[model samples]
Target: MDFAFTPEEERFREELHQLLLTNLPGDWAKRGLAEPIDSEERHALADLLSKQLAERKWLTMAWPEKFGGLDASYLMQYLFNEEMAYLDAPGGGGVGVTSVGPAIMMYGSEEQQRIYLPRIANADDRWAALYSEPGAGSDLASIQTRAVRDGDEYVINGLKTWVAGADRATMGWLAARTDPNGPKHRGLSTFAVPMDDPGVEIRPIENLAGERQLSEVLLHDVRVPIENRVGPENRGWYHVASTLDFERSGVASYARGKRHIEQLVDLVKENSTLSDQRQAVRYELADRWIELQVGFNVAQRIPWLQTQGISPNHEASVSKVYGSEMTQRIAGTGVRLLGMAGLLQRGTDGAPAGGAFARHYLTSAGSTIAAGTSEIQRNIIAQRGLGLPR
Candidate 1:
C-alpha cells in the first residue's frame, strides 16, 4: 500500500530526466514538442529521442534478455513512462513498445522475433497500427480489411483510417479478415506489413486542431510473406486482442495532468484575474485536482496488478475511461479560464501560452475515442469488472 517510489526508482527517474536534459533539442520544450502529432519533422525529432532512450536500454528494458532487453522489472518500465509523461516528452506512436513488440514476443514466429525485436528495441524502426476500419472501429469484430492467402504470401486489400504516425512508420501492424465465414471474430488474422509497399498509400488527415494527427491508409494487392504472420491463421482476433491489455493498462499519466493543473494555477495566481470566478474557479480547480488524483490512484493499482500477473480487466478499463475523460475535462476548464483568448489558437496575435490549450481543446476531442471509446470502456467495466450480463 506504500505510495512512494523506492530510492532506486527515484534514481532511475533522475537518470531519465538527465537524459532528456542532454538529448532533447535546445528549444524542444519551446516548440510544443511534448504534444503528440505526426509530421515529417515531429516524427524525425521523436525518432532521434527514441534512439537515445534505446541506447540507455531504457526503451525496452523490461523485456526478456534474448530480445535486446536487460530483464528489468515492470516497476522500472512504469517509472520510465511516468517520467516521459511528466516531461511531456515525445512518446511517438509507441506502437512498437506498447503493442507490436509484445504481440510478436507472445505469438510471433522465432524468425519474426529475431527480425523485429532488436530493431524495435533499438528504435531503428517505427510501426503503425491498422486495426480500425471505416465500418468497424469500436467493435473490431466487424473489421473488413481482407488478406487472402496466395502461395507463399497473403495479399492484403482494404482501407484503414486514423493510422497514427503512418508518415514516420517503416512498417505497420495490420489486422485483417483471412476468412469470410464462421464467427465474426474467428475469421481474422494479423500481419506485419511494410508501410512503403508499392500497393500501400498513406495520406494525412487534419484534426479540428489544424494538425495532421492521423493518416488514412489504402492497401491494394499488398503482399505480405506468410512468415510475417503473428500467430496461427484465422485466429488473429486473439493475438491482436491479447495486447489490448497492454493498451488498456498503464496509460494514464497523472504527471501530465498534475503539470497541467499547476500551469493553470500559476497563470491565475500571477494575474489578478478580473472575474469573481477566480475564487469560484479556485474551488472548482481543487475539486478537479482531487478527481485527477483519484484517477492517478486508480492507475497505480494497474501496475501492481501487472506485477502480480493479474490483468484487472475492469480496473484497467475504469482507469482508461477516467483518465481520458479527465484530460478532456481539464482542457475544457482551460478554455473557460482563458475565455475568448482560449478560442484563439497558436500563431495568432495575443494567443495565450502560444494557444497550446486552445489546440489541446481541439485535439482532446479524440482522446475518449482513440484506444477505446469512453462508452466502450464503461461497458467493459460493467460486464467484465462488475460481472454484469451481456
Candidate 2:
C-alpha cells in the first residue's frame, strides 16, 4: 500500500511549516520546546504561541465548524499534530486541546459544547486531568474519590496524583465515584471543575528533570455543578475509554518520534568526525530513521482508517506501544551517542544540543508511563488485538 501523503497534504505541511517560521516566537525552538514552561516568562511565550495557533484555527482543526474548528479533513488533524511535533510548537495547551476537548465534543451536553469549545478552540482555556488517585491508576475503575449530590452540586472529596498541569490550568476534568455501592466499573462519573475553586488544592511535584509540571491534586469537599457532569452519571468508564482511544490515536507520539529521529540524523551527519566508529554511528542513525519511517507510515494509516469508518482500536494499541517506546529509545540513544555532553543540563557551556537530549531523556520516561503504560498496551495488544483470553 502507498504510504506517502497526498500532494494536498504535502502542501498543507509546507504551509504550516511556513506559518511557524513566520509566527513562532524567537527562541521558541531553542528554549520553548526544550525547557519546561512552568515559569512565567516561558508560559507567557507559550501562550502567545498558542494564540497564534488558535487564530489559525489549528488548535481544533478536525472539529466541526459549530465548535470554532475549520471542519477540515481528518488528514489535516493528522498533519496539524505532525507539524506541531516537528516544530516543537507549544500551541496545544493542556488536556483541553489534546484529550478533553474532543471528548466533550463527542459526549458532552449542548450547553457544555457551547460554553467550553469556543474557549478551548481559541486558546482561552487550559485544562488538567485528575484521573489517577493515590492508589488507583492503571485500574481506574476502582477510583475511590467520592462525589455526592446536594442541591444542584456534587460534593467531591479525594486525592488525585500525577495531575499534570494542574497549577497552570483554569479547569480540570476528574473521575470520582458517585455510587459507593455500585460495581467498580459502574459507579464512576466524570466532571469538569474549576481548578481555582476553594476546595481544590494543587501541590506541585518536582521530578529529576527539575520541572514542576506534574502535581498532586487534593479535592476537599469540592462542589461541582450537576451541569458539569460529562456523559451520563455512573457511565464515566465508557467516556474515559473513548477519550483514551482518542489520545492513543491522535498521532502525537509518532510525530514526536519522527521529529526527534530527524534531529538525530542531522546531528549524526553534522557532528560526527572521520573516525573508526563513524560507520557504526551511521548505521545506528540509519536504523532509527528506518524504524521511524515505518512508524510514521503506520501512524498515517490510522487516521485514514478512521475516515473510512473503521474502529482502529487494535491498531491504536499497536501505534501507542510502538510510538511511546520508540520515543524513549530515541532519547536514550541521543544520550548514549552524545555521551557525557548529552547528559549536561541547559546553560552548561558545553552541553550538547543545548541539553535538549538530556531533558528529553528524563521526560521520555513518563511518556511510556502516562496515557496508559507500555505494560497495559502490551496487554491490550494481546487480548484485544490478538483475541487472546485473559
Candidate 3:
C-alpha cells in the first residue's frame, strides 16, 4: 500500500490546519486537549466550536450529501480527525458525529434519519451514548436495561454509568433489553431517548483527572415513541457492535499521542538540566515515537478498507487496542520524564507543559478500558480477525 495521502488530501489537511490555527484560542495549547469539560465555561466553548465546525459542514463530512454532509471520503474524514486531535481543537463533534450519527445512518429508518441526522449534522443537539452499565461495561450484551412496549411507546428503566457528556446531551443513543427471556445477545434493541424526559436523571461523576465529563444516567419509566427505536427489534446487540466499530476506527488517539510525544521531545531539547537524563532515555523516547507511527499506520488501514467497500470489524479492534495501550505507554513516559513535577495538576505554579502531561497521565488511565476493554478487543481480534473458534 502507498500509505501516502494524495496531493488533494495533503492540500485539504493544510487547509484544515489553517482553519484550526485561526479559530482555536491562542492559549488552547497550554489549556491542552485533555482538560475535562468540568466547567460551564468549557461547555460553552465546546458548543461554540461545534457550531463553527457544523457551519463549515466539517462536523459530519463523512456522511452522505443527502444527510447534510459533504460526502467526503473516509480518508478525508480520517485526515480531518487527525488534524483535530493534533491541535486539540474542541467542537469537532463528539460521539454524535463519530458513532451515533453514523449508526443512525446505517440502521435508522427514513423518518428517524430525517429527524436525527440533520440535528446531529448541524450540531443543534448533543448526544450521549447510554450503552455502558455498572455490570455491563465490556459485556454490553448483558445489560439489564428494560424497555417494555406500551402501546405506541416503549417505557425504559435502567441505569447507565460512565456516560460522558450526558449532562450536556439533548438526546441519548440508548440500548435496552426488549426481550428478557431470549438469549442475552439476541434480545436487545436500540432507541433514541430524549435526555430532557421527566424521568431522566443525571448524576455527575468526577474522574481521576477531576473532570465531571463522566456521569451516571438514570432512566425511570422514560418513554419514547416506537419511532425512536433504531434498526430491527431484538438485534441491537449486532447494531451496537457495528456502532462500536465506527467508534474505534479513528486516528484521533494516535494523533494526540504524537502531539504529546513531540511536546516531550521539545522539552528534552530545551531543558539543559535534563541533558543527562535525556541521553539515558533517548532510546525510550525513540521507541514511543516509532510505536505511535505504527499505531497510526494500523488506524489508516481501517479507512483504506472502508474506501474499498469493506466493513472493518476486527481491524477496528486492532487499531483500538494498539492505539489505546500505546497512549497509556506514552502517558507513562511523560510522567517519568517529568518526575515529581509531572504529578502536578493543571494550573499549579511551575508545572511542566502547563501540567498537560500530568493531566493526560490521569485521563489516559482508562484508554484501554473505555470503548471496549483490551481483553474484549483481543477476543474480537482472535475470533473475527483470525477466524479462531469461539
Candidate 4:
C-alpha cells in the first residue's frame, strides 16, 4: 500500500501550512503550543485564536462543509496536526475538537449539533472531560458520580478529580452513574454539562510544575436537562469507549510526541560531550522515533476504519497506551541528558528551553496516568483485541 500522500494531499498540506503562517501569530502559537496557559492567558489565547480560526474557517476543518468545515480528508487532518505540532503551535485543543466534537457529531441530536458544533468551531466554548473520579482512576466503571433523574432534569452529585483544563472550561463532557441497579459498566451515562452551573464547584490542583493543570470538580444536585444527554440513557460505557477510541486515533499523539523527540535530540547534540554519550543519545532518540512512527501508522488506520463503519476501539487503545508511555520515556531521557540544568524552573534566570524540559519531565509522569493509564491500555489490548479472558 502507498504510504505517501497523493499530490492533492500535498497541496492541502501546503494550504494548511500557509493558513497557519498567515493567521497564527508566530510567537503566540509557539508559546501556546509549548506551555500550558494560565486561566486568564488561556481565555485570551482562546478568544484570539478562535476568532482568527473562525475567520479563516479553519477551526472546523474536520467537519463537513455544511457545518462550516472545509470537508477536508483525514489525510489533510493528519497533515494539519503534523504541521501544527512541528511548529509547536497549539493547533486544536484535544478535548474540544478531537474527542468531544466527534462524539457530538455521532451521538448528538440535530438541534444539539447545530448549537454546540458552531460554538466549538468558533472556540466560543471550551470542554473538559468529567470522568475519572478520585475513587475511580483506572477502573472507570467504578465511578460514583451520581446523576438521578428528577422530572425533566438529572441531578448530578459526586466529585471528579484530575480533570485537566477544567478551570477555563465553559462546558464539560461529563459521565455520571445513572443506574445503580445495573452492572457497574452498564449504569453509566454521559452528558454535556455547563461548568458554571450553581451546583458545580471547581477547585484547582497544582502539579509538580507549579501549574494548576488539574482540578477536583464537585457536583451537587447540578441539574442537567435530559436533552443534554448523549446517546442512550444507560449506554455511557459505549460513548466513553468510543470517545477513547477517537482519542487514540488522532495524529496529535504522534505529532506532539515527535516534536519533543526532535527537541531532545537537539538538546543532546548541543550539550553532549563524548562521542559515546552522543551516540547513545542518538540511538535512544532513533528508537523513540520508531515508536512514534508506529503511532503514525496506527493513526493512518482510523480513516479507513471510519469508512468501513468500524469503531477502531482496539487500535485506539493500543496507540494511546504505547504513544503516551513513549512520550514520558523520551521526556525523562531529555532531562537526564541535561544533568544539573534539567531541574531548572521556568522564569528562573538562564534556564534551558525556558525550563521546558523540567516541565515536560514533571508532567510526563501524568501523561501515562491521564486519559487512560498504561495498565488500562494493556487490559484493553489483552481482553478486547487479543480476546484474552478478563
Off by over 4 Å in 3: none
Which numbered prediction scores highest in TM-score against the true structure? 3
TM-score of every candidate relative to the true structure: 0.95, 0.94, 0.97, 0.90
Candidate 2, 94-153: lDDT as tens digits: 578767888898889999999998999999888998899878887799799999999999
> Relative to the true structure, how large is the alpha-carbon lDDT of every model?
0.81, 0.81, 0.88, 0.77
- Measured by C-alpha RMSD in angstroms, how accurate is candidate 3? 1.4
- The sequence of per-residue lDDT tens digits that candidate 3 reaches over residues 1-390 is 569999999998998898777776777775665466576657777788788888989899988899999999999999998998898877778888887888888899999999999999999999999999999999999999999999999999999999988998999989999999999999999999989999999999988888888899999999899999999899999888876776777599999999999888887787777778766779889999999889889999999998988889999999989999999999999989878887887779977888888889998999999888999999999999999998
User: In every candidate, how many clashes are there?
Assistant: 0, 0, 0, 0
Of candidate 2, the 10-residue stretch with the lowest lDDT total is: 28-37
* Candidate 4 wrongly placed segments (more than 4 Å): 22-34, 39-43, 91-93, 272-276
Runs in model 1 deviating more than 4 A are 26-36, 39-41, 91-93, 250-253
lDDT of 4 at 186: 98
254-345, model 4: which lDDT tens digit per residue? 77777677666666667646356767766777888888888888777776576567878777777777778877887777677777787786
TM-score of 3: 0.97
Top-lDDT structure, candidate number: 3
Ranking of all predicted structures according to lDDT, beginning with the best and ending with the worst? 3, 2, 1, 4
| Model 3 residue pairs with clashes | none
